[model samples]
Target chain A: MTASLIRILPDLARYAAKALTEKKLRSLLTIVGIAIGPMALTAILGVVQGYSNYVINQLEGLGQNLIILVPSANYDMSSSDIAFLRDLPGVKEVTPFYSLRAKAKQGVRDIDIAIYAVDLDVFFHALGKLRLEEGSLPPPGDTASAVIGHYIAFDETGTRYYRVGDVLTLTYYSFKRGRLIQHSISVIVAGVLAEFGNAFFVNPDVTVFLPLDAGPKLLGMKKWSGIIVVADSPAYVENLTKFLREVYGERANVISLIEISKVVASITAAMRFITIAAGSAAFAVAATGIAATMITSVMERTREIGVLKAIGFTDAEIVTSIILEAILMSLLGSAFGIAAGVAAAYALSTRGMVLQGMQVVIRAPPEITLPMIVKTIALTIVIGVLGSLLPAHRAARIPPAEALRYE
Target chain B: MTRDYRAVDGAESTLGQSPGQVPILELRDVHKVYKVGEVKVHALRGLSVRIMPGDFVAVMGPSGSGKSTFLNIAGLLDVPTRGKVFLLGRDVSRLNEVARARIRNRVIGFVFQQFNLIPRLTIYENIEMPLIPRGLPRRERKKLVLKALREAEGDTSWLPKKPLQLSGGQQQRVAIARAIVGRPRLILADEPTGALDRATAARIAALFIRLNREEKLTIVVVTHDPELAHCARKILMIRDGRIVGAEAPQPQRCIAYSRR
Candidate 1:
């Protein structure tokens, strides 16, 4: 049976191709309509998947066993709270850092930046290793020394603002005795960190780092903004996070990377559902279009079908030929859609976009996997076959005697 | 005078045998009815006929006289509402569509008045249609198509041209080539020359006679043109779906014209 089918398939395919080419405009229009559905699906899914991968990679860089503890309200972590966290079981190390929004000026130009006062040893241990492109980390106990992120040293457009050993003027504001007071100081750039791409939640490449003692002198604040804790191992992250949450109660928000990943996964799944729903709607419209086209074809070729039947073609052969025509159209349209979709995805990823009314820039490049390709192809085939079924059967059931008489 | 022009070769004896031989096609008490909306129309009533292999017969009738209906039934394109049809000694009236299709493909060919060659196909592809259902190999199909084209006196150069590109007469010839390509034992043509002028019609009739004589193919044609009917060895006159008369023209005259 397989051998016979192989022998006859070429002829049927050729006949179908010839028929479609005869009505080139109609076939082309139908194919283009069908292609839109898969195209939208592939493009959207590719970008979404790429964005998820980017986030996961960033979390991995932050270390899987890391837990973050942030004050939920205006409350801040004190020295005793830090000591308590350091003493907790399963906690390998804890780094408390002070963060404040500030403005820095160099050579008459000013830029707003986040200032982080961190202990060099604890910061490096809790946040993973940091690579420097030039110079070296601020020397221990050097309160006047600071390390700048890649973005602060050279802006997005590659304009240099400050280099190693350059003095950057910083301005800090505080409310003291019911009045806002601003403090100004100068700090030397000890090093420039290498560029780190966008991360899961925070971008370390955009912040300035200073010696831990600078926070109290510069900002007139004695409170730590947040603490980063490293667990003994990945398996201990849950236990450490639970312990910190219980100790801090409502005062702090404790989270682990694994928990964050779960939340991200759920959000991604929702987005996937919406994207697939929209794509399936497009597919449904395309399927209807194909069915309409096939029905018209059947009606138009009634006399030809009669001739085929009269010339000894069985009903099965007639149906197979019609279905084959639809399948070929779908397969070709899907190929075109996949190429267009991938191209669109690549273009969108490379050309990052700025969020409207916000300072955020997003760059998501879609990844096309083998499974995605297989899924899209399978969907096209199913829609194509389903669309052609009724029309093919209708054509096959046409009585030869009556069809021959059709005008 | 009844004169047997069966071929001297024994191949002709296999067809056109003595009376006791099994007829290639036989219809007994056949009837057909069509229900159009609320009204019922009787297309054929108690029609019976027997056709021997190698016989060249024409059925003549006026419009709406059921000549096409009879031919459709005889060709196995339609089944009778009542009565049995025997093809090659098998009662095929009760056969399913697939079984009927198989027999039709293997044993019978049909040429229509409209020259129903698929318009999108080339002349060669149109002629090759019959062999497709048979699953014949490409090389073998090509040989058979070429031979049928030659038999129908169609130019090999026309193979690449679509059916609509051809003249009416050329289209009819291609249709004839398609019908004969499978080497079926029977050929049933319905108003085969109805769309052509007298000269082209005569040429088509002569081709049919040649196919019948040379290939020993049994032929049954339905037509309104008496000139085309005269080419046949026997003329069956149909009226109101009944075979009212059967006549044999002078055998020598048909032979002489076929020779021309």
Candidate 2:
């Protein structure tokens, strides 16, 4: 039985090809309709995967053993709080940084930038090495010196606004003596960091770094905004985080990079579900189109089916031939869809999009895995087979005598 | 010759019987009734016929006289509403659809007025259709197709051409070739020459005569043309689903008819 079935495969294939080619316009339209669903699905999945990878990489770049502590409402981190964190078990280094949102002006251009004042040695140790494009780090005890991000030193068109040895003025806001006050100061740019395109949540590209002691005096504030804590090893991060949470209780929000990674993973999974659901809806529409096309084909080929049955073809053979035709169309459409989808994905990953006049670059390229290819092909086959079944059965049920008489 | 080819029910002797002097087809008390919406139409009432091997029979009737219905029953394409149909010594009136299809594929071949060639396939592939269901290998199928094409006097060059590319006569010839490719013992043609010009119709009639005489093939044709019916050895006139007359034309008339 197997051998007999194998013997008929080539003939079945030939018949399927002939049938599809006979109505070129109709077949092409059906294929394109089916392809749209998979194409859209693949493109969306590629973009989402690329973005997820980028976020994961950013999280990894901030050391896995690193944790951050932010003060809750109506609370602030003082020197004593910093000292308590420093003496905690498994703590390698604790760097408390003061962050203030400030508006800075260089020449005639003005932009909003985050100013972070940290102990240079501990900050560099907690985060990895910072890539500098020009000049050296600020000298020790140089309260007037500041290191600016790559975007801060240059305008959007790459024109230099402030370089090494240039002075920039920053305006800081504070509440002093129960009254709103504004202070302005000029600081020399000691160095410019290389461009890091949109990886970290708080992008260092658009921020200025100042000496640790200068923050309280310059901002006229005695409390720290946040503190960065590094565990001795990655294995100690969970324990250290728990200890910090217990000690601070409701006063502070202690978050580890690992916890952020878990949250990011869940967000990506939710996005994937939405994308698949959208793809399924499109697939359903495409399947209906396929069924409609097949029904029309069966109707048009009624006489031909009669001829086949009159000659020697059994009802099963007739059904098999029709189903094979649909399978062939689906396979062709899926091949085209996969190719177009992958191309779209590659283009999206390589060339970033501009949203509201800001350029967003994807740091990771989209990957097409074997499992993805298998899944797409499997989906195509299922749609093809299911869509053609009813029409095939209809063709099989056509009476040879009546079909022969059909005009 | 009078012979009883009917096998006892549930007997193994029903299968693989040698092709002896048994009649090729026999319909005993056949009836066909069609239900059209709320009305019942009696297409055939108590029709009975016997066709011996090597016999060329033509059935003639007006439209709606059930000539086509009778041919369909004989060809195993449809079953009688009530009766016994015996093909090659086996009673097959109550066979299931798949069993009937198997019998049709193995023992019978049919030709239609429209030629019924699959438009998409080339002449060679159209002829190869019957052999495919039998699981014949490609080389063997090609051999049989070539043989049938030569027997039908079809043009070998037309093998690569599609059905629509051929003339009406050539397409009919190809259809004949397809029917004979499986080497069935019986051929049932319904209005085989109805769509052809006079000359083409005469040519097809001569081809049928030649196949019946040279190969000893049993042929049953239904047609309205008396000239075509004259080519057959016996003519059966049907009206209102009943066989009203059966006659044999003079042998001299058959020869003279072919000469024309």
Off by over 4 Å in 2: A1-3, A87-91, A101-113, A129-195, A217-221, A232-250, A346-364, B1-20, B239-245, B251-259
Clashes found in each candidate (C-alpha, N, C closer than 3 A): 0, 0
Q: Summarize candidate 2's per-residue lDDT along B198-229 as a digit string, tens digits.
A: 88887898899899989878888999877788
Top candidate, metric TM-score = 1
Q: For candidate 2 chain A, which ten residues in a row score worst on lDDT? A: A353-362
Candidate 1 lDDT over residue span B1-260, tens digit each: 33333321111223346756888888888899999999988999988788887788888889988998898898888999998899989999989887888888889989988898888788998899989878988999999999999999999999999988899999999999999999999999988888997678878988998998998899999988777787887777788987766666554444226444
How do the predictions measure up, each by TM-score? 0.93, 0.86
- RMSD of every candidate to native, in Å, equals 3.7, 4.9
Model 2, span A1-407: residue lDDT tens? 44656678778878888999999999999999888777877777877777777777777776788888999877878878778888888988888888888888856767888888888777766668467799877865887888898889987789889889998889878887899888898889998988866655456778888888877776666888889888898888888888889988998999898778778888888988998899888788878888899999999999898878877778888888888898898888888888899899988877764433233454467766768777887798788888999899999999987888888
Model 2 in CAPRI terms: which quality?
Answer: medium
Please state the Cα-based DockQ of model 2 relative to the true two-chain complex. 0.57
Candidate lDDT (C-alpha), each: 0.83, 0.82
Q: Please write out the lDDT profile of model 1 over residues A1-407, one tens digit for every residue.
A: 34655678889999999989989999999999889888988888888788777666666776788888878767877778778878888888887777877787645777777788878766656567467788777866787888887888888788888889999788878788899988787889898988876654345676778878777775556778788887888888877777778778999889788777767777778888999999999999989988999999999999899888888788888888899999988998899888899998898778764545434466767878989988998999899999999999999989998999999
